[model samples]
Target: MFSKILVANRGEIAIRVFRACREMGIATVAVYSETDRDALHPKMADEAYNLGDGPAADNYLNIEKILQVAKESGAEAIHPGYGFLAENAPFARACDEAGVVFIGPPASAIDAMGSKTRARELMKEAGVPIVPGTTEAVDTVEDAMRIAKDEIGFPVAVKASGGGGGKGFRVALTEDELQGAFEGASREGEKFFSDPTVYLERYLPNPRHVEVQVLADKHGNVIHLGERDCSIQRRHQKVIEEAPAPEWVVDEETRERIGKIGVDAAKAVDYVGAGTIEGLFSSDTNEYFFLEMNTRVQVEHCVTEMVTGIDIVKQGIKAAAGEELDYQQEDVVLRGHAIECRINAENAARNFAPAPGKVGSYKEPTGPGVRVDSGLEAGGEVSPMYDPMVSKLIVWDADREQATKRMIRALDEYLIEGLTTLIPFHKTLLQTEEWAKGDTCKELLEDKEWLKSTAPAEAPKPVVEDEDEETAESKYLVEVSGKRFDVRVVGPALSAGVVAAPANGAAPAAGGGRKPKRGERKGGAAGGPDLVESPLQGNMWKVLVEQGQSVEEGQLICIIEAMKMENEITAPKAGVVEELHVKEGEPIQTGAPIAKIVAAAAE
Candidate 1:
């Protein structure tokens, strides 16, 4: 085993690798960018090195800098934990040239399966069931259009040659949309992968994403763990995954067959370490077609680990060390069922936008059969410089039904305040009949009703306002932690209040004047209470209540835009709108006052 290994990634995955290395008595060296100086992974590792600036181009993706850090730290191996450089064949070859082991598949294997176009060709040659498409990248829009019109036909997918995770992909259903789709796909491909190459494929309207996990060694021994059903997705990204795919959908016989094909695919490339063979399964015809092979540890590998009772990371390291396979085909066993829900810092109701912000209150659920792999804590800052995946919630049970129930219970226990989360969205999916029956496909999110009804309902409106009622008895007073504050009632009853210290250490009154006492207002006047302020930094996307408007308890005040998506900011309590501090186009930082609501005076 290597004395020390350098983790060339960030976020939860880096922390995950660090934990595995620690358990194996192998010291870990973490590399971080400027923005991640205070990241959780760096704090967890034994030693950490600053790579460069915050930007990926300058730091995490800088091959020379990463190699330099590994050499300087005397690391015997480098583990690229998915994303960034995990599947970069050139990076693997560089490690070979630098006399350092890359803790993944060999460079040759990576090259063989790295390019979707090339992988399809190789899989076809190896007798694997491949999707019908162009074997090579189409160089021009004209060629793509011609192929779509003549060969692959309409309703085809134009995908980037070097794309994964839904980037650089477009679907065109008609001739008019082909040229635009081709140009958009090419532009995204060039910008993201520096490759303007794309190819066409026959689009399967509704298909379930199933992947087989396989492990190989230098001695040509290859074995598959099991299959994971990742049919629940949004915007081409998987939101939920499960192992031992519901027995009804993929029975024992089909599992064995798929496992063999997965192992064969790995052997075809002389693969090493952990990898996944992704496929698209159509229930209409019960036909499966090869999609692509992920050449590194996947984001949802925990599901496989739960069912196989195998430590994939440990195996990855051992395989890279030239160890022979410890388990054969017969040795592998599928235990109970497992499921994983990716908890991202995004809002599901508002188009699943990224909602990055400081975590004011962070609580993770724990119990039997529940596992949380996280890299965040209370007071931790979720930066927009990286993926919005805050953590992964995994659950295991004796069967798929129990696992699904446990997952739903776990999500309810999980709480993350001050920023929006996809928790509600995940909760709805867990209870859906389709999900419970294992009838979901990749097009699960295409349902408009599911998207609209999943979110919590809007709050009720407050009572009507009286413009001429500016009497002392009409004012209301609120107390927070024994400090009395005064506020005016514009429309209805409000219970929430915000405190901001004055310049001279004196407390501000209802209207920014001298502080008032309980039951006392300005000049002994009476009015309603104040409104709650946003607890995080974001942009106000929607104004739920206007000036002098009434609002009820838990009413959605506005949709705050943070990270990349919108988060519905709700009213803390019932009240009438007294003041509006933020507009739709205005940007608000953390703890910035957004609005104030005045509640009715006490009887």
Candidate 2:
């Protein structure tokens, strides 16, 4: 085992790795960006280093700086955690060449599965079940159309070859939509993964997203833990995940088959350490198709751990240290059902808009069968520069039904003030009949009814009475130890009277602020009807409109990148652009002016 390990990630995952290292008696090093100086992960690590001040590319994704920190901190291993450089092959190779173990699969395994197109080809060659699609990257719209129409037929998926997690993925049902989907997917692939390559696959409209968790050792021993059902999603991103996928949906026979297939996929790449093989399972035909492989511990790995009682991270580290598997396939026992709800700093009512700010008054749920993996506290800040996820609420029970109910109880008890969260959404999702049946509630999330109905609950207002009026009915009940006394107040009631503010300690009333002027908006310090203010805090990625350019209502004017997601700022009404206040690549806060728009003049 390594004496020290450096975690090359951020947020909850970083903290998770730190906790694992602590339990194993291994020192942990944390690297942070400028915005994350006060982040919980850094505060919890044995030692911390500042990678730099800027976006992820300049900080967390800076392989050289991370390697430098590892060497300086005297760390012998680097755990990528997940996301960012987790699946980057070159970074793994760099760690290997630097003589520091990368606590993940070898670089060769990552390279084999990093690209979706290449992975599909390898899987097919290895006799693993794969979806019908092109075996190579689709170059142009013509190629995509040919592949979709001639080979895979219509309703094909155009996905990024170099990434997963719903990024750079689009589905086109008709030939006319192929061109747009192809271009959009390619653009997103380049922007997110720095890879413009893409490939086509047969799109499954209602197939469930099921995945198998596999652990492999350097001694060529590979075994799968079990399957997790991650079908509940929004915008193709998983919102909830559970292990031992409902027996009614995936029977024992299917589970054993998929587990072996998972091991086969890992062995094909000579994989070592912890990894996940995602596949799309069809209920209609009882068939499953390979989706992609995650090369590190997953966000939903907690649920797998809950059921299997395996410390996957520790095993991964041991494997990296040239250790062999301690347990065989028969030794693995999956017990109760577990579910994980990803609680993100987002407003479900407003299209799940990212809500990044200081978390005030955070009260996590605690009870039997409940666990919270979070990096935030009462006063910690959730910045827009990283993922919007605040925490993960994982619950376990003897069965799926009990787990569902327990999850609802936990979600209801979890409280996070000063910022909107998905608690209400999770509560609503768990209560649904479809969810109770272990069915993917994708449609429920997309339904306007729930989206419009599940806003954060409002706090109740305290009653205020006039001090003068309270004098007529002033009564006080006083208690001393076990004794109680009733007394009538002669003047205004003490509770009714407001305390005078200290000379230098006066506080403002709630909702006390300068009101916007007529035709002015809520965003920006100074803004009129014409000012187009940013709705969220993020870095300006692109400005679509120029000065004096005419734009219609709801037209996209600019793009702001926040929380690794891009949000498009649109025009309020038809108008001519007046002035631009922000430039490309500049960081912007909520209510910051993006541009000014003047109503178009009538002829």
Candidate 3:
């Protein structure tokens, strides 16, 4: 076993790897950017190093800086935990060139699976089932149109060759959308992955996102640790995941077959360490097709760990150390069901808008069968500079029913006070009959009414009454000093001594005896036209409308990229763009006006 390994990641994943290394008696080194100076992972690791003072590109993704730190700290290996450089083949090769072990699959394996089109070709050659589509990159929209309309039919998916997490993926259901989807996918691919190439695949509108967790050693021993169902998603990003996908959908026969396919895929690349073979299981035909392969530990790997009783991260480290498989395929057993809910710092009410802020009062749930993998604390801050996932709330039980109910109970106890979270949304989702029946909540996620319904209901305000004697009064319940009490006041009106709970539960942090700070009033410049305010804080990726351009109601005005998700800002009413307050590539804040919209006929 290695004595020390550098964790080349941040947030919960880094902390997760730290814990695994500690359990195996291996000292861990954590690397952090300027924004993450006070992060939990750095504080938890044995030694820490600063990788300069810029965004991810200048810090986390700086291969040279990370390699320097690894050599300086004398770390025997470097573990790229999931995002950033986790699946980058060049990074893996660079680590090898630096004479440091990269705790993941071989660089060749990552290279083979790095490009979606190349992976499709390799899988096809290896006799692995894949979705029917072009095996080569589509260089132009004209070519994509012909491929989608003539060869693969309409409703095809335009995906980046080196993209995942829905970053460079778009669907074109008809010829009209082909060009835009192709261009968007390619642009995002270039922006996120430094690759402008994209490919075509037959889109499955109602398919289940299923994946098998694969573990292999350098000695050519490969085995699968069951599968995870990740169909419950929003914007093609997984929101929830479970292991041993409901028996109704994936039976023992299908599970074995899929598991074998995963093993075969890993052997084809001579893959090492932990990886995943993601597949799209048809909702109509019950057949599964190869989607793509993740060449590193996945965010949802904990669910599979809960069911299989395997330490996947440790196994990865051992594999990188040239160890042989310790367990055989027959020894592996699926014991129970596990579910993981990715709790992100976002508001589901407003299209899951990112809500990054200081965590004033962080209270995590704790009980049997419940585990929370988090890198946050009461006074920590969730920066808008990276992924919005606050933590992964994983629950396990003897059966799926118990696991679902336990998840509900656990979500209720979780108290993240400052920023808005998806706790209420998750609670509501688990309670739905469709969720209980193991049906992916795809339809519910699409329903705007249902999405808004996830927000907690506010208590009704007391009816105002006169101060006269025997006034018809309604009892008002309020919170005082962090305690709930029933105060029988003669009238609903506040007279002399009355206190209301602070917004976002921030009162307790304000000495628990004073009113919370007031927000600045929002009345913009006196002569300005109708202002188009930014809904959240993010980098303005694009400005769609030019000044003085006429636009209809709900017309696209701009796009803000935050938390790795794109949010489109649109015009509130029919108008002409008067003044553009901010330009493309500028950082904006919530409620800050980005443009001024005047009446269509106004001067």
Give the alpha-carbon lDDT of every model: 0.82, 0.87, 0.88
Compare the candidates by TM-score and give the number of the best one: 3
> Tens digits of per-residue lDDT for model 3 on 1-603?
799999999999999999999999999999999888878989999999888687899999999999999998999999999999999989999999999999998889999998899999999999999999988999999898887888999899999999999889999998899998999999999999999999999988888899999999978789999889999999899999999899999999999999998998999899999999999997568788999999999999999989988989989989999998777899889998999999998888788888887777778999999999998987787888998989999999999999999999999999877677888999999989999888878899988889999876652122222224222223456897998856443333334345444344444222323232333345554433498888799999998989889999999899999988889898988988888888899999877888888887744
Over the stretch 1-603, how does candidate 1's per-residue lDDT look in tens digits?
799999999889999999999998999999998788767889999998887674688999999999999888999999999999999999999999999999999898898887889999899899999888899999998998888888989898999988888777888988898887788678668766788899999988778888999999888889899899998887678899999788877878788878888987898898999999999987667777889999999999999999888989889989998988678878889998999999887656656656676676789999999999998887676786677888999999999989989999999899776666778888888887788788774345776666766664442121222433333213456787998756433333223363444434654456533334434632312223464666556667668689888888888788775654335688878878778888886777655667787784676
Point to the candidate with the largest lDDT.
3
Provide the clashing-pair count of each candidate structure: 17, 0, 0
For 1-603, candidate 2 gives per-residue lDDT tens digits of 789999999889999999999998999999998788767899999998888797788999999999999989999999999998999999999998998999999899999999898899899998999998888998999888877888899889999898688889988999998987898789889998889999999998889999999999989899999999999998788889999899899998999989988999999999999999999999889999998999888899999999999988889988998988777999999999999999998777767778787877889999999999998987788888778899999999999999998999999899787777788888887887988887888788788777868886683122222323333323456777978756434444234236434233555233323434534654455877889888788889888889989999999899888877778889999989988898898899877888888988899
State which candidate, 1 or 2, has the greater TM-score: 2
Q: What is the lDDT of candidate 1?
A: 0.82
After TM-score superposition, the amount by which residue 17's alpha carbon in candidate 1 deviates from its true location, in angstroms, is 1.0
Evaluate residue 552 in candidate 2 and report its C-alpha lDDT on the 0 to 100 scale: 94
Better of 2 and 3 by lDDT: 3
**Worst 10-residue lDDT window, candidate 1:** 459-468
RMSD of each: 13.3, 11.3, 11.5
